[model samples]
Target: MLKRKISDYLESYFTPNRREALLITGARQVGKSYAIREFGKSHYSSFIEINLLEDSIARTSISKASNSKDLLLRITAIASQPLIKGKTLIFFDEVQVVPEIVTAIKFLVEEGSYQYVLSGSLLGIGLKRISSMPVGYLTVKEMYPLNLEEFYRACGISDNIFSVLEEAFKAEREIDSIIHRKLMELFRLYLIVGGMPAVVQTYLDTNDIKKVVNKQREILSMYVEDISQYDINNKLYIKDIFNLIPAELNNPNKRFILKNLNENTKFSRLENSFIWIREAGVAIGVYNIEEPKLPLELAKLRNLFKLFSNDVGLLACQYADGIQLRILNNDIDINYGSIYENAVAEELYSHGLKLYYFNSKKQGELDFVIKLDDKILPIEVKSGKNYLRHNALKNVIENKDYEIEKAYVLYNENIKRVGNIVYLPIYLMMFIKNREIENLIWKIDLSSLPQ
Candidate 1:
């Protein structure tokens, strides 16, 4: 398996003197189970893994125990190990199948001395079933589809075009046209193929777009299967919402409006079903930012929201018809503004920031608004060349309602700063990791801060 950045997150979660049981939540086939095992092999002396799907007996055994110690003993016996506390890492894979396993995790944390990491794609929806439990005993680490930088890394292209691109970003300089042209081509392919682990690995091995699309379809099929089985209560509605995705993208607004489903459908009828998709990590909810300032959640208009599918490659497949890989062959600027912006939003989300859209109603809209250190930074994405359209950023600056430090426009090339804003290549959004960006921010002098 390709190494993931989340490995470091797992290492820290398990190593801390003040460690807590962890809940790893993400969409299915996103490498959650594989990651847990990889992490265990690297960090723990002994690892106990239980797949709730394969071993129904294991689920029954863990569920029957009343206390943490008994449950630990039960898990150890199922894995055929002694119940050695504090030395072994216990992982519950496909944990959503048995909700009681979640409660049991909390019990173990409070009453026993073992480290634990529980994970499932369906785990987010499963959270709603909890009435009460040891809430403070667990921490959550949410994962998303791979970002562009990670995609290149996984493909083993990090040494050449990837490293060159990273240097351009670190220095905030434009890339050479030749390299830029080549990298942009890869970036566009990534948009169409996406960052799903299975899809990418298949493409890497076969160099086949058809195989990649097939893999994407398999993932989509699983969501459909889940709606029919686990989400049976809302089956028809889930199917209805899933079918709306293609049309939703074609809409200029791209927000999920119930009327968009069918002329006769009402918004009230699909509210919980929408929540179900977001909770299941099948869709991401990008709320409208009423104001670009602190307390971004305050700006949310519950009824007006933009939804990005869990995978960009899947979205591309939905938008494009057969025999048109030619579009990706040309350039990023030709036909990928909305799709690239959605991919950028996913990248930002992986950095642990909630995605919000800047809508002025009268003025133009910014692509994303990210909150960091209680400050809202408006991020506008463009596949166009470095031509600054700072009207939206200007509006925020002139209003003075929110102290706008600086705005970012993610374009196809790097740009010089003008006034209180900086233009950046959207590629950097995928290439630069959060820690590296955080370090960049630390090195910025207030004296040279954008005015």
Candidate 2:
């Protein structure tokens, strides 16, 4: 089994003298259940697993229990497993379907008989329906699709490769050409296979690109089915927007145009549909920031935004016929710039960065805006070879109205510093939050580097 970074956090959570019940939430098919099960088997003496969606007996028993002790007794009786303190781990998979089970979590934590890890696919939506949350009693964590680092590890890539990349990034130097090409090859595969555990696993098992794409299509179908099953009222509207993401992103102005969906469509009417898709973890929204400044959320123009699929591979699957082949063969002739931009957004979002973009008719559009310490860094992503022609980034930095210091331009290029702007390969977006790298970029004298 491939290791997930969340496993390390879970290990610490279940270490000696645990205090709170754990709640793991993420999108469907992202491997919440699998990761929990793996952690349980490796860390616990005895693991009891219950799927609320499949096991009615466990659900009824849990719902009927009066207190923590009663709930433990019911669970033990139903699961036919002994619950020993400090030795047992109880996993509740898909607990979002049962609101009563969620309510019991407070009592279960207070009981403290066994460590608990509760996981659900649609927990975000379920959280809205929850009347009383287990505040201050449960530790919460969100699991995303496997990131680039995790994907490389799953493919048995050496950690030395990443270490070299980190060194190059900190020094603003290019990596060895041979190593760079190898990493880029793996990155291309990542674009096709995505970071979805199921899709990644299929690719690993077969090494067949066609099989991987077929699995992605199935996952896309499952997302639509999930919408139909959960949001019956807005199923059509939700599906319409979901399916239109590729088209919306490919436009010159990447902001999702309401007119494209329906000329008469009002954002107010379809707001919930958008919320449902985002909360479900199937998509991420990048809002337009009218003023690019600190406290980005406050400056967001809610109605003006672009929606990206949660996984880049899924986006590629829906893009067009033979697009995957073009991407694989490096024969891409279409406007595939949005695909790389979407990948960058997906990576930054996985690292817990809220998505925002700055668009100005006068100053060209900036792909992403990130706040680092006291500085608001503008990130421009170029999928083509012309990475140096960043007029928007230059204009944004030069504007006296906005107090911008330095900017980052991500493209298919080696790491280098040009004036106040740093050029990085798109794959290195994963390291934007590294402490050492952040410090190096902030303190380095860009004047020392040749233009």
Candidate 3:
């Protein structure tokens, strides 16, 4: 099985002496359950699995049991499996169906019998309904769709190559053209298949883009179904917003405008719908920051924001009918800037960065703004090879008012540095993190390049 970065964290969570019950939450079919199960089977002497959504008796047992010990007894009875204190792993999948099970986690951790791992889709919605949170007891982790690095691993890329790329990235040296082209090819595939485990696996197994997009559509349908089922009061509004993302992103500014949806529609009226979609993990919001400065969240204009699908492939699938094929064949004539921008957003978000953008009325709009140490870095995404003419980025960096030291322009180009701005290929986004940005500098060895 292809390893996920979260797997290492999960392993550490189950180390020799661990206490807190684990709660894994993310969108549906992002491999939360699969990761937990894989970890359990390999790490534990015995593993007991229960699906609260499918097993009513298990749900009833969990809800009715007065205490942790009683709950264990009920589980033992249902599974007819012995619960070894330290060697057993009890996994509860789809716990959102019975959120009472989540509340019971406090007592379960207190019991200190078997190690527990709970995973559920739409967990954020369930969490709102939770009476008492397992504040001090549960260890929570949010899983996202497979990132580029993980996707590379799934494609059986070598670690040595990745290490080489990392080294080049740190030195800000352009890689060999051949290697760069190869990675770009892989990145194009990633844009189509996305980071969803199932979709990626389907692509790997069949090498069929048609099958891959079919799976993506299925997942999109599931997201719509979730909206309909979970937010019944505003299902239409939520679906409308969801369906409008592709068009919204394709706009010049890419800011989500409620007026576009409906001239009379105010952000306040559909705030819950936005909240529901975000909480469900189907979409992410990038708020507009009026000023670019440290503590980017403070200057955020909540009403002014852009909405990106959690996965780029989904966004691509929604861009137009048969658009994925057009993208793959390079046959489409329209600008695909939104798809590339969405992919960058997903990469940044998966790295634990909050999304924010800066737009100056005088300077123009920058794609994203991220905080690195005490410096505010402005990132601009360009679809084509037009890496120059970054008026917005140049303005932000040059403006003494902002005092920005460095800026980034992600595009389809080899790595290079021009003054304070760094140009990186979009695929290299997976290598960027807040801690490492300080070491990332342009140090081109011109002598090494072929003349």
TM-score for each of the candidates: 0.88, 0.94, 0.94
Arranged by lDDT, best first? 3, 2, 1
Across 10-46, the per-residue lDDT of candidate 3 in tens digits comes to 9777876777889999999899989888988888888
On TM-score, the stronger of 1 and 3 is 3
Better of 2 and 3 by lDDT: 3
lDDT of 2: 0.85
For each candidate, the alpha-carbon lDDT, in order, equals 0.76, 0.85, 0.87
| Candidate 1 residue-wise lDDT, 1-451, digit = tens | 7778888788766764545788889988888888889888677777888898888899788768878778867876898565456678888888888877777677777765668888887777787786665578788888877877778677676567767776776666777887666666677778878888888889889988888888888988888888887787888988888777756755666777777566897667778888888888888889887777778888788877888888888787776565237556655435456686678877877777788888876666777888765676788776655456657767876677788787777776654467777777666776433443333434546886678
Candidate 2: Cα lDDT at 186: 80
Model 2, position 236: C-alpha lDDT score: 93
Ordering by TM-score:
3, 2, 1
Runs with alpha carbons beyond 4 Å of true place in candidate 3: 436-451
Q: Model 2, 1-451: lDDT tens per residue?
A: 8789988988877876776788999889898999899989888888999998898878777778887777877787877567777899999988887866777788887777788889987677888888888887787799999988899889987888789888888788987888777777887788878899999999999998889988998999888888888888889999999999999988887889888878998999988988988988999999999878878989999899889989988988887788877887777476768888888888988887777999888987889997765478899988777788978888888887788988889887678898899988877887887243444444667997889
RMSD in Å for all candidates: 6.1, 7.1, 8.3
